[model samples]
Structure formats: C-alpha cells, structure tokens
Target: MKKILFTGGGSAGHVTVNIALIPRFAREGWTIDYIGSTNGIEKQLISSMPHVNYHSISTGKLRRYFDLQNVKDPFRVVRGVLQAYRIIKEQKPNIVFSKGGFVSVPVVMGAWLNKVPVIIHESDLTPGLANQIASRFSTRICTTFPETVNAFNNRKSRYVGPVVREAIFHGDAARGLAFTGFSKSAKPTILVMGGSLGAQKINRMVREALPELTKHFRIIHLCGKGQLDPTSTHPDYRQYEYVNEELPDLLALCDFVLSRAGSNAIFEFLALKKPMLLIPLTKQQSRGDQLLNAASFERSGYCKVLQEEKLTPQTLVSQLREVSWDKDEYIQNMSRFQQNDALALLHQLITETAK
Candidate 1:
C-alpha cells in the first residue's frame, strides 16, 4: 500500500484542512501517518483517527514579537527538525502533506532533506511566517484564496480554494435542535464561535448583547475551552466549551453565524451557506490575517465585517439584525462558487506528486 505523512497544527485552523483530507486518502487505501507537536491540538484531534498513525515531535511557537522564549525557541525548532528528519527517514512515506503551522515547518524541512515531495496548503490570504519558511522547501503550495497566488510568485502555487470536511454537509437539524434544546416555534437560532481558543472580546460582547438578542434569536455559543459563563441561565441561550462531533448538527440548526474570520471556519460557514457577521482579530492580537480574510468575504458579499475596535453591545445586535436581513443575498453570492472542488484538486496533487 502507498503511504502518506501529514503535518500541521498550533491551532485548530491548521489541522482541520488535514482532517478533511484524511478519510479520502484512507478510502483509497493509503497508509496514513501524522507528525505534530506532542501536546498541540493536532495531537488531540488526529490521534483518535483509527487509520492514522500519529507521531509527536518537539516544536516551538513561532512568535513575531520579542520575548525570552524567542531566544530559546530556535533551539527547539532545530531539535524538532532533527526529530522530524528521523521520522521521515524511517517512515519513508511517498509524500508529505503539510497544512502550515509552526509544527509543520520542521516536517517540511525534514521531507526536503529526505528528497520526498512535499505539498503545503496555505489557508490565509497571505502566508504565515511558518508557511513562508516552509514554502522554500516545498515541492508545491496549494492556496485557499486566489489573492494568495500572486503573493507566492512561485510556479508551484495553485489556487484550489478551501477543503471543507465532508461531515459538515451531512448535519442533522433535528439532532442539532435536540442538543441545544431549541424548538422550531422559538425564535431563529444563531451560532456564535470565537475560534479554537475563544476570543474573550467577542465572548464578552456577545454576553452583553444576549438580553437584546435572545428576544429575536436563540443562541448556541461555542465559547472555547474553559471560557463558559457558568452563571448564564438564559432560557434562550446555550453555551459549550467546544463541540467536535456535534458541530455539524449545530451548523445545521443555526440560522446565522457570529464568528471570527479564520479562513477554515469562515469557509465552512460559507459552504453551508450560513450568513455570517465576522469580527476578525485586530492587529494588536494577531498579524491582521483575519482582517484581510474578513474584508475579502465582505467584498464578495459572503459575510458582514465588524471591526473589533468598533464593537459594542448595541453594534453587535445591529449587525446581527443586518445579517439576518441580508442573509439571502449572501447565500446567493456564495452559491456562485464551487466550494467542494478544493479537496479533489488537493488529493489529486498529492497522489500525482507521490508517484
């Protein structure tokens, strides 16, 4: 049987695309393996897959800011590269597929050193620092946005769009309603997501808006790990730390979305044709990639963007109302794009490159 190795994850966004591709490869009878940080979210998510062999290596965070850890992380990264090199040499997989993250940098480098073909997928409008470094060692780079193609300026860059999980399309609305204790006779349901780590600012604003919002909408809040408000007992509000298996059903039940503008999460919402009000991370919190992702979605009529700095309880409720009013138009515009082809193209690239 053919064998393939995958690597990515500091956050859920980096690992989700790889998750979407795993089953397809498994069905085709490829022996699949994954290399990630020992305690990263990727290890938690991918380790449970029955068909995937998961390997953990030492990895360090790639930070743009100066800190004491910055001086020490380079050494960790070097160690990670050596650890990855040993894994690649032993596994001898046909190809290495990377969803770019700090963990993926060493894996891509190790693959290059082993003379194995490496394909890296970038889900942002512009490459992250890890991907920027991995791109040099990769044989091909797949992008989710057309705008990202020009940024690479490399002949290997291909714009294939985002890979959405198959399970997302098979959501059961009944199961979703049951999970949230929402009724059809009640107000419309809106799902609020703050990304993998949960955005405290967005969570705070949503809680503040609940009194007004619950009058017109039932809320299903995925509040991130350990961020739940235990005192919240609103009849129309439900809170979760996170949902893995039930997420598709939750998406099916939601009439709209209030979310961060991470490319993977937003694209999944877009594919489901859920109207969204996006509050991207500001420059103070991130490299501003979420801002660019939100702007692109807004420009294409896929969602509404609310600048984080301008956010308030009143503004949040107003934007939610606006998104409801404009929901059909956003769905109509999203319908014009073929969102499902991304996985097929990416799978083909990996298969052909492996040969």
Candidate 2:
C-alpha cells in the first residue's frame, strides 16, 4: 500500500486542513502519517483521527531577528531534519504534502533530500518566509489566492483553493445561532475568535469591549485554548477555550466576526459568509503575512482591518456603532468576500495532483 505523510502545525489551521482531507485519502487505501511539533496540540489533536501513526519533533521558530535564540534554530532544525529523515526513510512515502510553518521546515527538507515529490499549500495571500524558502525545492506549490501565485514562484505551482474542515465547508448559520443565544429572526450574532493558540492583544481588547458591544448584538467568543483566565466574567458572554464540537454550529449562527487575520480563521469566516472585522497579528510575530492578508481583504472590501495597537475601546465601540449588519454596504462587502469556492477548488487540485 502507498504511504503519505503530512507535516505542519502550531496553529489549528494547518492541522485542521490536513484532518479535513484524511477521509478522502483513507477511502483510496493510502496509509497516512503525520509529523508536527511536539510543542503544539497536534499530537493530542490527531489521536482519534484516522491515521497509521504520528510523529513529533522539538522545533523552534526561524525568527527574522538576529537573536541568540535564532542561532540555536539551526541546531534544532538539524535535529528535527534528522528525526524526519529517519521517519521518512522508514515510510518511504510516494509523496509529501506540507502546510508551511516552522515545524514543517525540517520535515519538508527531509522529504526533498530523500527525492520525494512534495507539494506546498500556502493559504495566505502573502507567503511566509519559511514557505518561500521551502518552495525552491518543492514539486508543486498551492495557493489560496491568485495574488499569492507569484509568492511561491514555482513553475509547478497552481492557484488551488483553500482546504478547510467540514464544519465550515458544509456548515449552516441557523444551526450555529444556538451558541450565541440569538433567535434566527433576531439580530445577526457576531462570532469572535483569535485562533487556537490565541492572541494577547485581541483577547484583551475583546474582553474590555464585549460587555458594551453585546448589549447590541448577540456574541459567541472563542478566546483560544487556555488564554482566558477562569476568573474572567461578564454577563451575556459565552467564552470558550476551545469548541471541539460546536465550532461549525457557532460560525453558522454568526452575522459578523471580530478575529485575528490568521489565514485559517479568515477562510472559515468567509466560508460561513460572516462579515469580518480583522485584527492582524502584531508585526513582531506574523513574519509579515497577516499584514498583507489584512490589506488585501480591506482593499477588496471583503472585511474591515484594524491594527492591534490602535484597537482602543472607544474606537472599537465607535466602529461597531456604525457597522449596521442590515446595511447595503455590509451585504456588498460580504459578497466580495466570496471570491471563490475555496474548498471545492482545493479538492479538485488534490484529486488532480494525486492522479
């Protein structure tokens, strides 16, 4: 039987995308394997998912800054690559599919060194430094946006749609409104999120601004895993560290969303047809992709983008005050957001690639 391995994690986006496609691969009788960072939730995440086995490696971020810690990344990467090399040597998979992140670096390289066909999927309009570096050696590159086409610069690269989980891909908002406590005929509920790992600035601002905003709109906030203190409290607020089951339900119920401009979250929101207010992660952490995504989404009028430091309570409330979900502008903007059927497009790409 043919074997296949996946490598990418740290954010739920990477792992979730991989998980979404497993059922499709399994039906073809392929043996699936995974390699991700031991530091992340990947190991626990895939336990129940269908897979032959999974592996983990200690990995560090490749910071653009010239720091002493970054110097150590080389050693860590070497160790991770060796670990990946051994894993790959054992599996001898026909192909490797990687979502780009720091954890994927050694895994991607190991596959390349072993002469395996590799494909890269970069979901953001702007590619990450790690993806750009790895693209040079990949057999094919996949992108979520047409603009990201040039970022990969691979002749084999194509404009494939995004790979998103079933919940959002096949979700309905009427079903999700239960989590927001809003009747379907009532005002549109807003879903707030900061991805799986969480964002400090987003969490702080939402905590302060929500009580005021919720009076006007029903809200469901996913505060991220382990980010919200148990002591945190507010009336009419439903907070979750993670929503393993109700994720699709909540998103389907929402009218609008305030979230960090992570590629995965953005795709999920768009897939659900919820208008968005995006806060790009601080420049310090994004490796420049969040800023680019926010800009692109804003220019396209798909969503409003706000800088993290500039997110003052009064300013947020003021913006929310004018953001009437009933307005023609909101409808127009959201229409622009449905740029493509990302999931269907991705499925077609994968099917073609597998051929």
Candidate 3:
C-alpha cells in the first residue's frame, strides 16, 4: 500500500490544505499519516480522520529574538526531530508533504534524513520562513503566487495556486444567506473574519462601526475563538467562532468581505468571488511578511488593504459605505487566476517523487 506523511498545523491555514489534499490522496489509493506538534490545534483536526495515522512531536516556534526562550528551544527541536525520525521509520512512508509552519520543521528534516522524498507547498505571495528554510532540502516546492518565486532559492518551485477545499470551488452565492442566516434580499452580504484567533484591532473597529455597517449590508462576523465581547448585538449580524457546516455556501453569498491577509483566507475569498478588504496583523514579527501580501492584493485591485494600526471605526464606516467592487473583473481575475488543481498537483508530485 502507498503511504505518505504530511506535516504542518496550528492554524486553519495549515490544516485546511491537509483537509483539501487528503481526500485526493485517498482516492488515488494512498494512505496518509500526519506529523504535527503535540497539544496543538492540529491534533484536534487530524485525530478524527479514519485513514490518517497521526503523530505529534514536541515542537516550538522559530523566533527572530535571541532570548533565553530561544536558547531553550533547541532541545525541543532535538526531541521533535528524533520523534519524527522514529515515526517515519515505522511508517516508511513514500513521501512527506509540508505546509511550512514551525511544526513542519522536524518532520521534513527527519524525512530528509530518512531518505523519504520531501515536498513543500507554500500558499502565499510571500513564502513563510519555515517553508523557505525547509525548501533548501525539499525535493520540490510549490507556490500559489508566481511572483513568489523570487522569495525562494529553490529552482524546482512550481507556481500552483492554493489547494482549497472542493466545496469552495463549487460555492453558490444565491443560497449563501440561508447558510449564514442573513437576508438573501440584502444586496451585499459582507462576511467578516480575522483568522482563527481573530484580529482584535479589526474586530474592535467592526464592533464600533457595526451600526453603520448594518445600514449598507448584512454582516457575518466570524470573531475568532475568544475575540468577541459578548455585549454586541445586531439584528442583521451573525457572529461565531466558527461555522463549519455551510462556510462555502456563506462565502458564495458574500458581496463584500473583511478579513486578515493570511494565505488561506485570501485564496478562499478569491475562490468565492468576493471582493475583500484585508487587515493584516501588524503585531511585531507577525508583521512577518503579511504587509507584503496585503500590498500585493491591494495593488491587484482584488482587495483594499487596511493596516491594523490605522483602522478606525470612522475609517471603516466611511469605506464600507461607499466602496463598490468591480464584480466582472473580480470574477474574471479570480477564475483565471485560481489554481483549483492544487490538491491534485500535490498528490501527483508527492506520489511521483516517492517512487
């Protein structure tokens, strides 16, 4: 039986790609195993997959600071790498596919040491450091943005758009409100989300600006797990930590969207044909290249970039009140630009290289 190992998790951006790629791998008669950081969101997500054998290693983040915490992390990496090596040895998987969060480091490093083919897929216009560092040894690197090639030193990088779930490619805007519980009659159904943790700055602005926002459009505010204040109320506002059942349907109905510029969120919004306003986190190192992503999309006319520091209730209300999207151009650009075959390509590349 064919077996492949995959790594990367912590956020939905990492987990979602695994979700998107796994079904395709299964269909092609391959068994998938997952390696992730212990006690993280990845464990919760992958544990339920019947065909996936999940393993967790003690891992930590890669930081730019020269702190005592940084000094303490090498032992974690040593332990993680050793654990990953043992998992790989037991599974003897054909290949390892990575989506470059710090969790992926040991998995790919172990896979390389074990002579397993390693492939990395990056889902941003700017590649993450984990991916870039891993790419040095990756058999191949796949990227969503063609322009991102300059960000990598790997020559084997392929310009493949993000591998979104099959559900997203088939989203229907007409029935979106039914799924999100907003008004189908509402001309613009704005979906507002700020990554999994929710952007406090954006959420605060939206909360302050809600009265004005509701005047122009019904809103779906997917406040991250703990971000909502619980005091805000609106007849036209739907709020949640997450909505899994009908996300695609809700996305389809959205006429406008406000979200963080995380790689997955950007691709998902583009797939749904929703024009966007991106509020990238400007928090310290999290400034970790999101600004570049926001700038790129803003320049392309696909999204309006809003800085977290600069976003205010008045600014958001003023913009949302008058902003009009070029639906035709958006649809055309997104359809032509989207690489819907990302999962298939990953499956093919990993399977081929594994042999």
Candidate 4:
C-alpha cells in the first residue's frame, strides 16, 4: 500500500485541512500516519480517527515574544526533529504532507533528511513562522490565497485555493433551527465564533451587548471550551461550548457571522456566502496574520473589518448592524467567488510527489 505521513498542530486552523484530506487518503487504501505535539489540540482531533496511526513528538511552542520557555524550546525542537527522523526511517512513507504549525517544522525537516518529498500547505496570505522555516526544506508548497503563491516566490508553489470540508456545504437550516430551539422569527440569526479555544474579549463584549443585539438579531454563540456563562440567558440567544457534527447545521441556520479573523473559518464563511463582521486579533496579541486576512476579505467586499484594538460593546453592536445593513452587497461579492476543487488538486499533487 502507498504510505503517507502528515503533521501539523498548535491551533485548529493548522490541523483542519489535514483533517479534511485524511479521509480521502484512507479511502484510497493508503496507510496513514500523523505526527503532532504530545499535548496539542491536534492529538485530540486526530486520535479519534481509527485509520490514522498517531505519533507524539517533543515539540516546543513557537512564540515570537520573550518567554522563559524560549530558551528551552529550541532544545525540545531539536529533540523533536531527531524523534521525527527515526519515525520516518521506520515508517518509510512515500511522501510527507504538512499543514504548517510548530510541530510541522520538525516533521518537514525529518522528511527532507530522509530524501522523502515534502509538501507544505499555507492557509494565510503570508506564511507563518513554522512554514517559512519548512519552506526551505520542502519539495512543494501549496497555498490557499493566489497572492500567497507570489509570497513564496518558488516555482514549486501552487495556488490550490481553500480546501473547505465537504460536510460544511451540506448543512441543513431546518435541522439547525430545531437543534437550537430557535423559531423562524422576524429577526435574523447571527453566529459568533471565537475560534476553538474561544476569545475571552469577544465573549465578554458580545455578552455585554446582548440586550441591544438581541433586539435586532437572534444569537448563536460557540464560545469555546469553558467559556459559557451559566447565568447569561435570553429568549433569542443560544450558546455552545464547541461543536463538531452539529456545526454544519448551525452554519446553515446563521445568516451572518461575527468571528475572529482566522483564515480557515473566514474562508468557510465566504464559501457559504455568509456576511461577516471580522474582529481580527491585534498585532500585540499575534503576529498580525489575522489582521492581514481580515484586510484582504474587506478589500474583496466579502466582510467588514473590525480591529480588536478598537473593540468595545458599543463598537461591536454598531459594526454588526452595519454588516447586517450591507448583507446583500457582501453576498453579491461572495457569489462572484469561484471556488477551486482544492482537495482534489492537493490529492493529485501529493500522489505525484510521493516516492
């Protein structure tokens, strides 16, 4: 059987594309293996897949700011590379595919050391730090944004567009409404997403603006783990800690989205033609990738940008209302977007690159 090794982790954004592609490889009878950080979210996400063999490696968190862990993380990363090299030597995979996270750097390096072809996929407009390091060691780079292809400046780079999960396209609005106990009231439904871990600032602000927001729109909040408020309740509002199978239904029910500017989530919203009010993470909180992602979507007229630095309960309410008023225009711009069959293109590329 053809064999393949995959690696990515840290955040859900890093691992979601791999999750989308894994089942395809499995159905083709390929033996699959995954490498990830010992305690990262990827371990939890991939462990549920019975067909994929999971390997844990000692990976250091890649941070930009000064931290005591920074001094120790390099050694951990080196150890991870060694462990990954051994695993690759034993598995002897035909090709290695990485979705680009801190854990992926070691896996990509190990694959290069083994002379196995390595393909790295980047979802953002610009590459992340891990991907930037792995790019030098990679055989091919796959990008979601057309502009990202130029960012790489490599002949091996290919613009595959966004790889949206098939399940996302099959959501049922009826099922979603039933699941949430929400009626087809005159008010439109707004889905608030703060990513997998939840955004404390967003949760606080949204809750603070609930009295005003609920007057105009019904709310469905995916507040991440342990982010739910036990005392907060409203007839027009619903909250979920996090969702898996039920996510599609919820998406189908929502007419608008208020979310952090993660590339994967925003693109999924775009694909579904949902008007969005994006509040990207501030430069102080992140490397500013979210800001750039939000800016690009704003320029394309698919969403309205709200900088987190300026985020207040009042600002949040006003921006959401603005997005609602301009909803039709946003949908029209999104309708013009012709999505690529990225999963198929990526599958073909991985197959051809395999040894």
Off by over 4 Å in 3: 172-176, 283-287, 325-340
Better of 2 and 3 by TM-score: 3
Ten contiguous residues minimizing lDDT sum, candidate 1: 179-188
Each candidate structure's TM-score, on Cα atoms with residue i matched to residue i, is 0.98, 0.90, 0.92, 0.97
Backbone collision count in every prediction? 0, 2, 1, 0
Which tens-of-lDDT digit does each residue in 139-185 have in candidate 1?
99999998898888569899999889999999999999888887775
lDDT of model 4 at position 109: 92
Per-candidate Cα lDDT values, in order, are: 0.92, 0.75, 0.79, 0.93
RMSD of each: 1.1, 2.5, 2.2, 1.2
Off by over 4 Å in 4: none
Q: Give the runs in model 2 whose Cα sits over 4 Å from its true position.
A: 172-187, 325-328, 336-355
What TM-score does candidate 2 get on C-alpha atoms?
Answer: 0.90
Candidate achieving higher TM-score, 1 or 2: 1
Q: Which candidate has the top score in lDDT?
A: 4
Poorest lDDT segment (10 consecutive residues) of candidate 2: 319-328
lDDT of 3 by residue, 1-355 (tens): 8898989986878788887888778777887899998787788778877688888898977776678888878789888899999999999998899988888988889998899888888887777777877898788888878888777764788877777788676767656756666554635778898876677778888888988888877888888877767788887888887766467777877778888888877877876667787778775747356787778777766777767777899888766654444556656666665355776777777778988
